[model samples]
Target chain A: MKNKFIYLNNEEKISSNQNKPFVYLDNGATTKVDEETANIIKNNIVEEYGNPSSIYEFGLNSFHNIENVRNLIKKKINAEKEDNLIFNSGATESNNFAIFGMAELGLKNNKKKLITTKIEHGSIKAPSKQLQKKGFEIVYLNVDSEGFIDFDQLEKELDENVFLVSIIHANHEVGTIQNIEKIGKLCRKKNVFFHIDAAQSFTKVEIDVKKQNIDLLSLNSHKIHGPKGIGALYVRKGIDLKKIIFGGPQENNLRSGTENIPGIIGFGKATEIGFDKNEEKVKEMKELRDYFIEKVLEIPNSHLNGSKDDKRLCNNINITFDFIEGEALLMYLNMKGIYISTGSACSSRSLEPSDILISMGRSYEQAHGSVRFTLSKYTTKEELEYTFTCLKESVENLRKLSPLTPK
Target chain B: MTLEYTKKVIEHFTNPKNVGEIDNPSGHAIEGSPACGDMVNIDIKVDDKGIIEDVKFKSYGCASNIATASVATELAKGKTIEQAKNINWKDVEKELEGLPQVKVHCSVLAVNTLKKAIENYEETIGIKKEAKSIEEKAYDELKNVVNPNTGNMLVDDKLIKEVSIKEKKIILKIDLSDEDLYKNNINDEIKEHLEHLFDVIEIIFIK
Candidate 1:
């Protein structure tokens, strides 16, 4: 089959004013909505425009499409009949709903303690803190230098008062994949609800929610080459998750709104295609990512962040070049039409260093000098080669002009 | 969001002028912290009469630092030390068209280093005077000039500090707030304004 992904070469160098192919290496922030996904969205808007909540044939068609999408996701994750998916705006909203919903439920049961890691996404972090303000005790598990939460530390923190254990399946910045299965089992043995923010790892990592004993899972479509505005949270049937959004009863009153029909259809199509080609794409993306990592680290004074082995995601490569700023490197690469990001996209605009890296025990300077290059299935070997060339030159040039003295 | 740097900023950043260090320089100064991701080191060669013969800088920062420092050296070269010392960060920002709101600190870094270089030159030479000379008096008057961006007198805000003075060269230091903006051409403007009172040979600033 012909490659449907966008490809750019040196001859087609794109500038800000031009429409040309450019190297895209920041997939962790967001991926290009694949052609199939875009088409589904277009068809849904033009041909199947209906509010899923209305009691009519068109509305029923939209409602059926949403159910099909939910079932597809549930099947992909191996969720059992006990688990049901409810749609929300995206992973942030899904995560907030899961955390705050579970926290509220836990409060009624006299289980006022919440457990999570320092490496979780901001969406999870923010609501957990808000729970603290409402007199719920919050315990943050610290990740090791390689970005893995210590199971022993987690086991020690788990008790009857701890109502839920929320952890990121894969870190968005460093791409470290936590052993969610083991974490889930531990939480199950402790009789605590387990919530996984699998936004970055949903399809990439095969998650059997039933076998893993996951009480809740947060996922979004955008990171999986789907539409941007749709995501879902899987709540285990027995878990009492209090409603966070209230209005006309929708999603069985778990969430209430006119469902985003086009976004939902696009998400379903993307997931179907993503899972069908998962094996080949994983292999291709892994080889490219590893090769890029091996080659990029050859640049002097550059070193990788997170795991050196399989625990890291196949698509992620975060590295720090000593003596130069990451923002300067990002700017230089951006000027060359090689798009990458420094730190987390959520905090990139702020002058502060990556708090995630700081939590992993890196010094402020190391955190400040770090950049992330995330690959997608669309990334080809040739693109990786070109990116390396640009990166090496940019790093050398910025280092030459750097005032940070080499130690 | 991507910061929209001015075209001049892109130019100076891509092919920065006077981008190396000077050996056995008459004056030298460093400002900002690399740990915090903005820093600049300026070296200046001044004549015995206090004229700035040459200036060079090495910066560690985003595009703004390189651009602002490039413009700073271009503005200070061949000007009297007093005039160079009187240069403000606002003028550097103006010369580069304008810097983004966040990058205005780059201009402050450049201007502060230039003044510090002048101060280093004055300290190295035993050009101390028993009384305020004509050039020193002129510097005193020009020293109170307003920061173009803030519109406040430098003296009243205590943003500008007098470092030291020798026979013909004077050094001043500007302590920029974390939020100060940058502009260009304040050096030449100050020199023309003060030429009536002093035959100033050199000036430097430190921050």
Candidate 2:
């Protein structure tokens, strides 16, 4: 199923299913490229193969097309004309550049402290740790049991020495959406740079960079049904970021890399479909997510992980079942053709529970029992019903085999 | 395409065999814990002449844990007590066609739990190690019971608040929270360990 070259032609799109139902519930991991976006990518590959930097009509056309997608993304994010988007390999590089690029300026300005929450993705967390080696004080704000970062802690941590307050907009594991507007206003008031790792929430939620006062926003493509290896960092035309990745002065002397023409076009097309306010698709996702949660919680001793209200992402359903390991539940679901993910340590090489759940005050057992089913725009009621049925059977059967279950 | 696990692993994990508890079991054993992310509890019913009648298992682990225990229980169901103890991790792996290297520990846990269940039964019917004093007997019997807290011997932890043996009776006071997640595990461990060493085990939990 990990066919990287499946996009080479249309015939390869049909996987050998033997007619078994293939319910994809791991969209938080990555979404399948929609037909429109895939077609765009294929056409861009075959027709527009010129490098954007070449000095000819073909190259000029490619360069203009890249700029057109950039303009489209700017409109989608609703940034001012002064704001700029720098394309990169994905959110990982964008998050790195947003952090390390600012750290260089912060070092000269005596802003040695950086602020972030414990639940930020690894791109943020790992770089924060690296900065610590360079004598940068990184403060991790705490979160409540529902995965809400303490706003008061953020306010207290904001000081002249703090350079960046990078937080994940929607948590990848539990789907808890932070109050980004409030966070932006606080950072803007303090004149501190506020960055958001919006890889998981960029298209799922409505984001206005100017209204939110976001300084740097990390956006990715594959999570929103676009091709992978392409993302953008929206710089609000103010923060002077030192070039961490130095090269031939491409990306307007900001980020130096050859333009990924096809990737940029796919990102633009996917964002057009995602950020165009497709309320019907979003409503279906919300309804199906709620219905799946309700049906799954009908099983005894099952608890939802994140907020049950509008604060949570519409397509994310994370639940913890008592007396069962999340990895086992995932296996059972996989057997039933329900592809999902888990927070259990046994399935990981490090053997540590998810930091997002642990920071939310879930014990090791509770964290290990967590399962996340992230629906996509294509997810349907029938798929959810089948998932629910398989989920109930797995939990019941696995709980019977769990030593933690009372005899 | 097949997953890293073999077909038998997928089969056993999907619909495991003999995955439950045996009420009024002749011997019972629990291994590992939830904090470690994998735990196995095996119960056995043995007939006369040391022949295993029925065996069942419950797991708080992953696919490998459940499948390994399922296969181990199936292998131990009708075997004699000695043969059941000989059912090692390698045999479980071979039966499952092969477990991933990371999941090899799961097979070991299942086999250890099964062997411990048989050993507990061995002690119950006066077929285990010789004992001198009540404390020594209790310690020797419980020496193999892994601590649910630290994955060490249960005797290593300060759970025994007080212990006194009057004739054949062993009065033991243990300090454990009433709401301890592993309370039942400790109880099962105590009974499995002390049942052969003493005619009576008077357990009093200190709140």
Choose the strongest candidate by lDDT: 2
Provide the overall lDDT of each model, using Cα atoms, as 2-decimal numbers. 0.79, 0.83
Local accuracy of candidate 1 as per-residue lDDT tens digits, B1-207: 446676678788888888778899999988655545667889999998889989999887776778899999999999998899788977987888776655665676688789878888987896544666664566555542445455445554766566455655555555645333332233433454455554553334444
What DockQ score does model 1 reach against the true complex? 0.21
lDDT of 1 at A326: 80
Residues B1-207 of candidate 2 have per-residue lDDT tens digits of 123677688778878898778888999999876866788889999998778999988888988888999999999989988788777777888898876555666776788888888878888878877656668867756544443443333555556778888888888777766676555555665775577677888877676
> What TM-score does candidate 1 reach?
0.83
User: Whole-model lDDT for model 1 versus the true structure?
Assistant: 0.79
Candidate 2 lDDT, A84-177, residue by residue in tens: 7999889999999999999998988988999998888889989999999989999999999989999998998899999898999999889899
Candidate 2 - CAPRI tier?
Answer: acceptable
Candidate 2 local Cα displacement, residue A315, angstroms: 0.7
Error of 2 at A394 (Å): 2.1
Q: Scoring each candidate complex against the real one, what DockQ results?
A: 0.21, 0.26
**Could you tell me how far off, in angstroms, the CA of residue B20 lies in candidate 1 after the best superposition?**
1.4
TM-score per candidate, in order?
A: 0.83, 0.83
